[model samples]
Target: MRATVNQGPVDIDCRPTLPNITVMLYKDGQQIIPDFDKILPIQKKGFLLNDVSFEDSGIYYCQANNYTRTIILTVQDDSTYLSEPEIQIPSNTHFVLGSPFSLLCMLNISKNMSQSNTKLEWVLPPSAEV
Candidate 1:
């Protein structure tokens, strides 16, 4: 049966047969699950759409014919689209001694800087003035 929730589009579903039925959900097999979040009890052989969460991701079991059946539920992460920022230089990348070298330093930015053409200056160490 379609497990619609919050009147929103259904992401997952659950189906249990008769002979072992109840409004509340039960963990099948000998494995005892302490908490069953997001899943509402099945009262009168019907489940509504107001149940589910991202953390409720796992295998669920239902008892039938003195045996247990399994159903896997999963939620995808929205943060997967975010990419890592490009590094200007390796953390261990060091300069050689006695050689005048310039490294284009990157400014610490919280947002994307790719859209702007702004130039960044390398923050150099303090020079010794005598």
Candidate 2:
């Protein structure tokens, strides 16, 4: 999964355990770990990188003997493109006695639906009819 900067301790897995597992981690083309930690293989068969930053974004490679796995890691800024919605519910309304009263509620999701696949709905009161 892609993570934002300062958002994670990313774990890259090392697969195909041998009798003696010696895993090495590489980022881009440079090696990160020369020697595997003693407890890494026993604990999770992976490496946990704490508080990843933008500089940590690259193609990660896990090499253990001949078996290897590669992953593309993209780090993004925490800023969001969408702002809080401005809700405008009427503050005051007056109706005469025995007069029919109707209320309308509207929600705008135009900015939030660009990348979303989920649906949004508003439920009406049980006594209300459309």
Candidate No. with top lDDT: 2
lDDT of 1 by residue, 51-129 (tens): 3445444555555455444556454433222333344765677777776655454444435444365454445468942
How does model 2 fare in lDDT?
0.61
TM value for model 1: 0.34
How many residue pairs clash (N, CA or C atoms closer than 3 angstroms) in each of the candidate models, in the order given? 5, 0
Error of 2 at 87 (Å): 13
Q: Which ten residues in a row are the worst by lDDT in model 1?
A: 1-10
- Candidate 2 per-residue lDDT, tens place, 24-126, comes to 7788878885334321333445676666667778888888787888877776534422334444545787866777766564434444355465344566799
lDDT of 1: 0.42
Could you tell me which residue pairs clash in candidate 1? 4-49, 5-49, 6-49, 23-42, 23-43
RMSD of 2: 9.9
**TM-score result, candidate 2:** 0.50
